[model samples]
Target: MGNSPRPGLWALEKSTDYGKSFKPWMYFSDSTHIKDISIGGRCMCNGHADTCDPADPNADSNILYDAGVDEKHQSLDIYGRYEGGGVCQNCQHNTEGINCNKCQPTFYRPSGKRWDEIDVCQQESGRCECRKEFNPPNCDSCAYGYFDYPNCKPCTCNLNGTEGQHCTPTDGICPCKYNYAGQSCEICEDGYYSAQCKNCNCDTSGTEPSICDDVTGQCICKLLHGGTRAGACVRALRVRPRRLDRRQLLGRRQVQLPHQLWRQAVQPPNFDSVKCDRCREQFYNYPACEECNCDPRGVVASFAGCGSVPAGELCQCKDRVQGRICNDCKPLFWNMQEYNPYGCEECRCHLAGTLGGLGACDTRSGQCECKSHVGARTCDQCRDGFYRLQGDNVFGCTRDCDKQSGQCRCHSRVEGRRCDRPIRAHYVPTLHQYQFELEDGVTQSGPVRYRNNEDTFPGYSWKGYVLFSMLQNEVINVVQIPKSSLYRLVLKYMNPLPDNVRATVIITPESVVDIQQK
Candidate 1:
């Protein structure tokens, strides 16, 4: 009923037409049926149908082809033809199939190449394994105190012991230590010595041996003359002396004896004497004769030599004219007025005339100038009709008389240049006429007259001595007389004699006449 089957594997209609059609292939239970139906004896019903050839089963064939077959199925039947089943399954390049298990020289694999594989990559060495002359690891770094070399070796020594490599030490190069001397410790000369060889003797002459072997001790000596030598003595030529005299050197035997020396040589006594150049003055001995003796009234002790005295010499006054030998005042004299020894006594004079001009009384001539209105040789007191005023030296006269009136210009109470009068009570007299006698034997009279019932009289009452004999029980009153009256003043007093009274009197200066009343 169905069309006879094709050979090899049956193809779906879609596979035969490259999937363009949809007819499905048939499958049979026996190959006899397929061979009887198709011209090829091969059957198409079995899976080996692809191995069957249409021409001949025994003929060489390109079995890989099937029209419209899938690419995956193309190689599916070739497994038995190659050495390994699949393309690489049992080939030499197949890692699992071969016994070649080692990895390539330069290549490495962390996982095993085979069941017991070994890793083949090289391991790195650490920095410590590098050489000293070069830097670690790669030999690229240089060591301490060295520099890198072109060949990778480090440059070793610093040159000339200076800055570069290969350096060496030289002479005259080291610094000297404290207290040491020498170009190179040559023998220690005069002052110096020691180990770093520095030290000195430091003596006055610089000739002394070093005390502490020139190292430890310093020079010590007397000031100025001192040095390292402890007890060194200075020469006598350095001493200085003050005085030089042959007479002063009695004990020294250095000089030859003089001719007069042996004659009086037992013991030349030391003489201490002073001589006077003028009559009684004296001087201390010999060469530097300085001091002198002076007289009681002389002044030579102050002056040094005879030549120092002035010419026309005398033991004179210490000052100009003061002392004895013309040294003191002559006779009854005083030295009041002038200065110095030349001063002489003063002359006596009145205070008013001399106080401003001459100072004191003149002892040489006892004369003095009289003050105005005063007339004594010494001018010690005031004259008649004048009086001494307030001060000791001042004087004044009674006021002048007024000739026309015969009355004083000033009343008796006022007695100076000015007529300023003192006031007092008026006097009244009982008698018509009265005679008055003064103690000094002077007398005056006046007619007792009345002026306004009060008797007016001359005001000449002064205190002095008056001698008058009074008659028993007869009281008498004496009063002043005015200059205008014509009565004669009596030197004696006579009372009207309640019967007859008479008294006798004597007046002075031998001039004023007495009036005898009847």
Candidate 2:
């Protein structure tokens, strides 16, 4: 066929006869008579052509030369001899091809083209396989008490008598260094004990017995009770005696004793020490009798015959007197002169002005003369700011003033026997009327003005003494005292002046005359 269409770019051509049918076709070299079609640019067969020039033989050969195609794929032939399907290198079924499926069974594949070597699969056993010591089977590492090599290994005992595989056991059974006891060697030497053999008994007088090791002769003592010597028992001393009962002895009736005369059969006579007729139960001796003094303040009475005495024998005090003989006067009442039978004949204070004095009452004076405010025989007076109002009664004096006018007014606001406080302002007469004269000889009758806004006085401010009668409407002028310039304020009235008069005057410092007149 037209020198066999160039290899890779081959196409079937129509036959010369119109009735002929086509066949599955590929290209072959015309002179060599060999099929030369490539699949993926790989050469299918090895054959040479006669008409192909040596320099550029089979210019369109099936062998691809493009760098984009793989070196292995450049020689692959589509219609060449067939090779059986190959398996992946990673799989058990894989024989001779690149492992296209790189993962083992139950594993995922890795990204990349298949290669000759295969990759291992990840574990999918579903059970944990790590080997920790305390961890269960297949654990990757050993737990705390166990060490791990390829497999888990347990700890070995530290020494003999140690049972646990672990280095530390619940009870450290190894014996203590020396002189120690108990499972952990917590106690020490025989009777003495502690974490170590550090203490011993030293107290010798205590109640408990001390101990010593049988072999070493070292002192050991019981807890809290210790002694210096070994096996020495200490006893406690100083015990108190029980109380004795005495109630039964006091309840006995009259006790009697028998007198023993000389008898044919001689025998020792029993004698009772507590048989006394006069002294009763308390007195043990019989020869002397003691009297019981019932008075708490008196001395006990004892005699040769009586066992006890009653309270009547003690001396008593009379009205104003006290003591064993009832001779001294009572506290507040003092005695001045000597007196008998009646004790202090007249109870009195030390001073003349107080109560009863040394002698009888002063019938002439009626009562003792007390100093101004003082009372009684002592001359005691009322406290400061106080005065006596009634006769000799010290309780009557008061600090109040008399109620009537013209009396020394205790206070302008108060008007009573006792100036306890101010009287109501509304009750006092705030204004008063009078006659007065002026400096220019003018006269007037008016009310005088008081500093308290409520009080007023009607009068003038000139020369002369003006006499105004409160009862009769009379105003008369009298001689004025030159020194008392205020006399000028009196007045000679013009219009039968009103009953009350009031006036206002201004005085300057330089106007000595005006001020004096006011």
Candidate 3:
């Protein structure tokens, strides 16, 4: 039954053919006595009341409120299918859906809990309350481990080296330690001088070692010591009573010598000198003092030694000097020679086109990185539009010419540096038409042509320049076109050039083009 016409009256209705033919069920009620069902709407229930265990209000044992529940939309009963009517009144706690059997999110039954009283994962004050560390989305894992969950474990890490979010429980390997580097925190940093890289014991003494082990604090002797430490040198014993052995007659000259020295010179351990740092240059005791091979002007001198040290000393290069021997100066800086008045002077760079305008050149090869309108080492030669004059400045080109500008500057008869205007012409995107006065006072204009042989030759004009040219190649008009489009070039020569003359037609370098001639 849905609703009655009278304000507070209703009747039970029945449908004979799937709600087509209806009749009353013989019962009626006031709107206040029972829930009012709409004339055509299905019945539905309100929220389920918590009544499974009234003695324990907080305890979970709730069931659905089934009075007005829609059987078609919700479960029928507590132990029946889950999709017939609304949950019954006094439904169980932590139970959802129509039947009240499904567990709520983050809630699971403990070993001893009843079926209606499933336990919540995180409980507080006898209610399903999630802890701050773990979200309800997933109770399996947590960060900054302080407590363990059923799905997650507690983290283990040393606070000094790692703590909180830095801990990796899966790999069990600390990302990095306080002072140590590498996988296991075993090696020192690149400036492996000391523990904190604060102190360097190398070269502290007269013959101080140049390098040392970072961890062991041991001196690494230079190669001159035969890759050995200072302690590797052996001690020698002195012998007395020298005598000559088996002297040969050399023009009756007396060459007698000590017997001990004569036998030792030809026997085992024929030594010449002992390894001593104090005997070397600085005269101060050192770890390893090898003999000095340093040039007076190319090395630093401050300490002395009596032990074995490196013979190969580091050299300080002189001004404008290159190489360990200081034989040559660097590029762009001259005043070469072994000894020059000007130390190493930077090359004088001029404003105007100095050959290729390369500031300086290589000292050895005299090669320069060329610039615009300039090339060659000296930068004293003009590339184009520059006349070669007797006196050349740093720019090299003394007089401007037609090379760069293409403005011919030769005699009227020739009109171009290479006599190319009247007899020969060059084609470029900028040039559109060229008219010349003939001998008989008649003007003969070059052919009008389009660049890249565009489709506009018949009716179209590129920037107002026609595509038809009287003399082929006379007026070259190069242009910029998209690469993907086809290159269509149609040449119609209205006048033929004399056998002796030829025009220069140039296209962009490295461009691939095709001619679609009609």
lDDT values for all models: 0.35, 0.36, 0.41
Model 1: per-residue Cα lDDT over 386-496, one tens digit each: 544222453423224543654546656554345544546634343436645343232234322222211222333433323333322222344444543454444433232
For residues 1-518, could you state the per-residue lDDT of candidate 2 as single tens digits? 57865664455655556748665455544465446643222322222111112233365542223333343343233354233221111224222222122333555423332433333233232223343454432354455445444344554423221223232322223444345444544445454532234434534343234345432233443445433543222222232324433331210111122332221221111222323233344432333332332222222122222223333333333444554433345333344223333334343322433332222223212233343544554344554555643444444345433445424436566755555455766353222233334322323464322122212334533332333345323322343333322322332343346666654443333345554232
Q: Could you give me the TM-score of model 3 versus the true structure?
A: 0.21
**Would you list the rank order by lDDT, best first?**
3, 2, 1
TM-score ranking of the models: 3, 1, 2
**For candidate 2, what is the lDDT?**
0.36
Instruction: Pick out the ten consecutive residues of candidate 3 with the lowest summed lDDT.
Output: 262-271
- Residue 333's lDDT in candidate 2: 36
Kindly indicate the candidate among 1 and 2 with the higher lDDT: 2
For all predicted structures, in order, the TM-scores are 0.16, 0.15, 0.21
Better candidate by TM-score, 2 or 3:
3
